[model samples]
Target chain A: MKNLNEISTRLEIAKKKIKKNQIKDNGTNAASLGKALKISTELVASVVVGSTIGFLLDNWFDTKPLLTICFFILGVVAGILNVIRSAKKMHKINKYRKR
Target chain B: MSLNPMHQFEVYRLGPEINLGSINLSFTNASLFMTISASVILFFLFIGTKKKSLIPSKIQLVSEMSYSFVAKMINDTAGSSAKPFFPFIFTLFMFVLFCNMVGMLPYSFTVTSHIIVTFVLASIVFVGVTIIGFIKHGLKYLELFVPKGVPVILLPLIVIIEIISYLSRPVSLSVRLFANMMAGHTMLKVFGGFVISLGLLGGWLPLGFSVALTGLEILVAFLQAYVFAILTCIYLNDALNLHH
Candidate 1:
């Protein structure tokens, strides 16, 4: 019984250690997830906003689809800009973490 | 009664339906779940923080961890400038987290699954951040649409690009949360229906997948909440610090 108790206590301590490591891993994982999701959403959102604004402007100015087309192109560019900016932000965070 | 995956998202009126003006102001399952989630958060926090013992109980530990987690997140993302907005951000995080979590329970409505709901939340943050920026910097807040260190010739193009990106914040934020919750729950329900349809021997495979999917969805629920809060902090950082 004494030996069994010692082994169980050892097991419990080991389990606790593993749990701590897992928690650390999860923190890093969540951070990376936040980065990845932010980039994707930023990409889509810029385009959507760009196109909507352009379309509305075209309607108001009686320009038909001209402004819409121009804005859509601009939106794509903006989306890429967003992705780059978010990537840079993430990179900066990683550098800070290292220090 | 039918094993339809889409049925889970249907908004049904609960109790007396009230109409004010031309708008339908009926209490819905969505509203009920929202109330439930809010109450659950309050109840949990109330009970958890009640015991301030030195040797902390389980509830106290959870409460403390959540407090520290949001505190740390705000500090890391927004720095000291966002100290004033801590309560609002914390409440947003907890509300969304609870809504996502409570929805994971069977037969519960997922309030975050609706685009309108998430969009409203996102819009509030967007408008609030914009207002803060203007209040802090006056007309200079428009400077946010212009990134630092761009060549003179590229100023107009870059400004437009930045403005477009700025306008997209709420759209992306709301859609990301709404789509993630809706997609995960729908997939879970679909797989669940398959498990039921294919009984005994055949059902085992789908049952296993459903189990795995549930685990993934739970992670997603937490991650989406984190993403929402962190993004808000980042936006707050921009408004507060004017980081280009």
Candidate 2:
């Protein structure tokens, strides 16, 4: 009975240790690279989407370059905002993991 | 060896071409590799879980590890409310992962490298999540576009920005995976061409770089799949919890 209790306690400790290592792994080198990759694409994609919408609206409204120019600026803002938002979220996750 | 690096990305039909009016449904190398990866995943899981034991075999250990990894990811990101989507998220992860890993082989075609394929997958997620948000929150789902503390004066611009960001989800999701895979493979092929062209004396440098790059590409293959799945989870969380 004593041996069984000791083994159970050891197993619990081992499980906790593994969990901690996994959490730490989340913030490691490759994971950071993944986050970097995601941010770049997010930035570019939003700009592309914004400009496409603007261009389409312009074509429909016969406004030519007017809506396109407006949306291009808006797209740039949206892209920067996206990068900041995702960066903040990542920072939060990393800080939480550290604890 | 084809000197042109872009030659590897060329899609050629394997069997007789099947054309349905303007649309071609022929079995190409991309389709073949996709089928191969799907079968490989199916076989791995089937055999892995065929027998249950206290001490699992190597295959079972790997299979179980993947299952738990995805489960934990969902739990952490989407919480318990997202439990029902586990099967979908798991399948998406495994499919993308296998497609990527299989593509790492010498002659295998990468299905996900194509923008169309990844776009379709991302569209499914985007559309499904939107439907789910509407079903769960009804008209209130439109509130997702409205910021909480924004002044009424800036609300219109903010809402437009929000909508643009929302629409970009599928684009970003699809482009990220497709671009990563395509760029990595193209770089690898370009370096390989360098190795061949440089000859025995000068080839050692690019050859060494290729070896290092192959290792990096494998890591990237795994990482991109992981990113893809986790993003899906994050999107699902937004729909389910409406935490934005």
Candidate 3:
């Protein structure tokens, strides 16, 4: 019974070690270039989307720059928020992997 | 050799043109390469699964590895509830991976480098996920745009920002893959041009750089495909789970 418990604990430790290695691999394997590309595109895409909607609405309402300006600002804010959200997620994953 | 790097991306008709009224649906190099990539994937997978021995063959191992890779990705990101989507995510990953890999060959057209192809792919994922969300949660799906706690007065602004962020998904998804592929290929071509123009003596530096860039480009190609598939899984997770 003592031998069985020792073996089981060893197995548990081995499994945990493997899990830690896997998490570390995942954290570092994603190239920084890819992350940069993903983040930059996310920011630009949000801005583009916001401005497009604003521009279309302005055309419909004949407000010219009003909606366009409003949405452009909104888009920038959204883009920053998007960047922050993704950065936080990445940070969380890294933190978990570190542990 | 053509000095113009952009010339590689030209889409000329490959055979007799097929015009549907105003629309011209002629087969082009892009179509050819896409077909090649698809057939290559089909052939590889066919061979991979043909023999079921106790010990796996190399091709079988490769196919199995890829299958498990995608399976694990979905399982991790979306959980077991997303098991039904395994085939879809697998196919998307394999197709994109094969296309990107095939494009790495000299004189081959990079299909994913084009905005239209990536855009269509992103749009499909976006639309499908939205439909799935609606089917699964009905009116509750709208709650995705609303946060848990916020002042009532500021809610509208927050909602608009959330909506804009949501709408940006497809655009970002497509742009990320397309831009990476395009930029990498263009850089490789530019370096190749530099190697030629610089001649034997000066060419060595650019040639070395080109070799390294090729290695990096191959990595980028694989990374972009993985990113594309993983993003799809993440979006699918959002739809299925409805978690903010």
Candidate 4:
């Protein structure tokens, strides 16, 4: 509920405390914070969907070798799909907000 | 040996290249794109929350949450002295959050996964803090390396160690974020690749792992962003307290 200025002011104080203690990045928090967290379900779906296409392509080309190519392309498509899905989610969330 | 995992850090060409200087800036690498993604998110957040009225909406709620979260962290860890530095801290949070979150996307780049991006942010903190320290304390800022209450004999040695450690903050700060992001993403990528290569015979296990891993990665994205911002808060505490 604090104003932006008040919030920023508190952060400045915290920054100083960190410096004085020689606060290293090690274990500042409970566990190491990393990208392993915050992954979306859509991302997992993307890869699965990509793999399905690749599996089908491998079957279609009458050669399993094409699976490799199909999978590679699928990966890119999946990445793009992730972006689209994320954008849609953001938009949806925005729509949900009122007032 | 195979290419260093770090070698994957270079920028590449994607579309018609444009020359800004001696270097061509076209197909930017994962790092550059992550930076752009962060900026885009910031832009939208700004647009969404810019409006102020009798009622607040979803974007406003998020914006408010982000603002208060940092503020509370600062108050709890560093106190009121952190006020002036909120903007920098906010930017850091957004940037790290974006990088970590975007990296969770399939095959998308994780800029924070590299040391360079994290280093840039850390360095800014270092330079900013150092300047602020000196500005506030003037010549007295030198006292930060020498703590009170230590035994007389150990004073000199302790002071030396403190200075060395103080100087290393930038490297440590940068590495913590970078290593976490990089290691997590690499594991995800490897597991993801396997989920495909193993065929149906072995695919089930890796697919299951991928789902769990993806869920974990999302949590991490928020965590890293919070950690990075909170650390910045801690740093601000030192400057204000002048306890050293």
Candidate 5:
């Protein structure tokens, strides 16, 4: 009975250690959720900021629609660029994670 | 008892409305919930950490788990250079987490569902990151917008694109949190109304959906808070390291 109790106690300790380690492992996975949520926001934000800046500049320069049109295109490019960079970062993380 | 789903979001003065000069400082349900969230966070953390034990109590375990979670997030996303900002990031995470979780309660208001609140938080991060970038790198912070290995001919265009992306950070960050919370809560409310109006026999379907959605929202509540903090870490990383 004493030996059996010792064995069971050891098993419980091992189980607890495994649980702790699992929690730590899960942290890295949670970050992917954050990454997924972020990409779209980054794209939308770039366009919005680009157009706002363009609209303001056009108003200041008294050139209606010209700057806005230019900025809108620039914003789209910027959004694409932002998305590309984040995707690249994600790729790097995935590679590291694989290792 | 009009069965209006939108009524859940209504804000009304809770006490004597106070106006200080040009500003209206009326206390509303939103403000009340914010206070509740903040206090709840404080209480949780305080009690959780007060007993420093090798073998933690359940409360201490929760406190420690959250601490390590945020710590790991910062270290992974922002690197050790962002350690000094841990308190700010941790507080932000807990506050948002509490607000989100508390809002899930029946008859509770979600402070984070509002753009004004999330916008303020995002703007603070935006301004802080910008200031940090400028202070750390001086004029070179502008280099953040200038991609490396670009041809001289395309430098100006690339820079403009970069600047647009950089400027979009706050709007995207704030809107993402606000929209997620707002949409989730609205969907829950809408389904809840269906459960009520349909009567018990017909209400089971919507009730089941409401149950599932509540579970999903709980997950989302935790996730949005994590995203908020992690993104802040990423921005801080960019500022601190000047990483492209």
Candidate 6:
């Protein structure tokens, strides 16, 4: 029936309006996903990169724990690499908004 | 016992391949089932609301609520002007929800539990949203990378990192759903196997565990769907607003 179609259309419109409202925060969630991924990747990268560096340093210095500590610190650096990058991007986004 | 818990993830070839000249049309069993499930639910909803009455019934109320819920999510995440996208968004939500819900049935395939399935869905969402961003802002959409309020020295490094992180969204989103659903279901199946094998004594404990896990899996089914929808809305927002 036309009335049924009509109701469906109106319902559709109402639905659209509601979706539009909820979607405004969707950017935040997407960014959150991005951050989560970056953090995870960075964590893995850090452990691998750090431990490798540590092992290499151990080979260089002939010391066990020293390279381990040093590489762990290096891993932290890589992790920070992701964090800072995301933060700066956020910053630019915020700054661009005011202008 | 199937040695490969993940043997269920295989893609099956189907139909006596239909040919449109060079293009072959073959659908997988997974695709077929998903479409069937979606159709069943879609017809159910369409029939439920066939009667146009001022005072709504419970089914109608539920139908209306789902509409509102999805609509609100899109509107809030993607902005009001993004209204044209409602049907697609609605379809996405319903299909996902149906797949997840269907997964709750005994001995049924959890279609979304496979990484390929989840990844395909996530990739579609990612590509759709990325295309929207390009359409809305052209090349300027890249501006999403440079965020505000950093000291002058650190800007360049930040942008590169942000871009890398941004690009990783589809994989992360897909993986989260795939991993959670797959892991939970595998553990459930394993425990369930234990329940059958252990007879009365050991079986009782696993039986209880299976019950608890089933309840949790149901919650997870809903949550994963919500997360997917919510993330889709966010991506839509970026396209509509370009947010940076």
Q: Highest lDDT among the candidates is held by which one?
A: 2
Residue B134 miss distance in model 1 (angstroms): 0.9
For A1-99, candidate 6 gives per-residue lDDT tens digits of 887889899999999999888645555654455456444644454445556667877988899888677666655555566556557865775787669
How much does each candidate deviate at the interface, measured as C-alpha RMSD after superposition?
A: 1.2, 0.6, 1.1, 17.6, 1.4, 7.0
* lDDT agreement with native, every candidate: 0.91, 0.93, 0.92, 0.68, 0.89, 0.73
Better of 2 and 4 by DockQ: 2
Using DockQ, give the best candidate's number.
Answer: 2
Number of the top-ranking candidate, with TM-score as the measure = 2
**Range of the 10 consecutive residues with the lowest summed lDDT in candidate 4 chain B:** B1-10
**Model 1: pairs clashing at backbone N, Cα or C within 3 Å:** none
The C-alpha TM-scores of every prediction are 0.92, 0.93, 0.91, 0.65, 0.91, 0.68
Q: How accurate is candidate 1 locally (lDDT)?
A: 0.91
User: In model 2, where do residues sit more than 4 Å from their true spots?
Assistant: A1-27
Listed per candidate, the RMSD to the true structure in angstroms reads: 4.4, 3.0, 4.9, 19.7, 3.4, 9.6
Which parts of model 1 are misplaced by more than 4 Å? A1-24
Q: Is candidate 3 or candidate 6 better by lDDT?
A: 3
Candidate 5 regions off by >4 Å?
A1-33
Clashing pairs in 3: none
DockQ scores of all models, one per candidate: 0.64, 0.80, 0.65, 0.03, 0.69, 0.07
Candidate 5 residue-wise lDDT at A21: 80
* lDDT per residue as tens, model 1, B164-235: 888899999999999999999999998999989898879999899999999989999999999999999999
DockQ-derived CAPRI band for the predicted complex in model 5: medium
- Candidate 3 per-residue lDDT over residues B57-124, each given as its tens digit: 89999988999999999998789999998988998999899999999999899999999999999999
Comparison by TM-score, 2 against 3, better one: 2
Least accurate 10 contiguous residues by lDDT in model 3 chain B: B48-57
Question: Model 3 lDDT vs. the true structure?
Answer: 0.92
**Interface RMSD, prediction 2:** 0.6
Candidate 3, which segments miss by more than 4 Å at Cα? A1-31
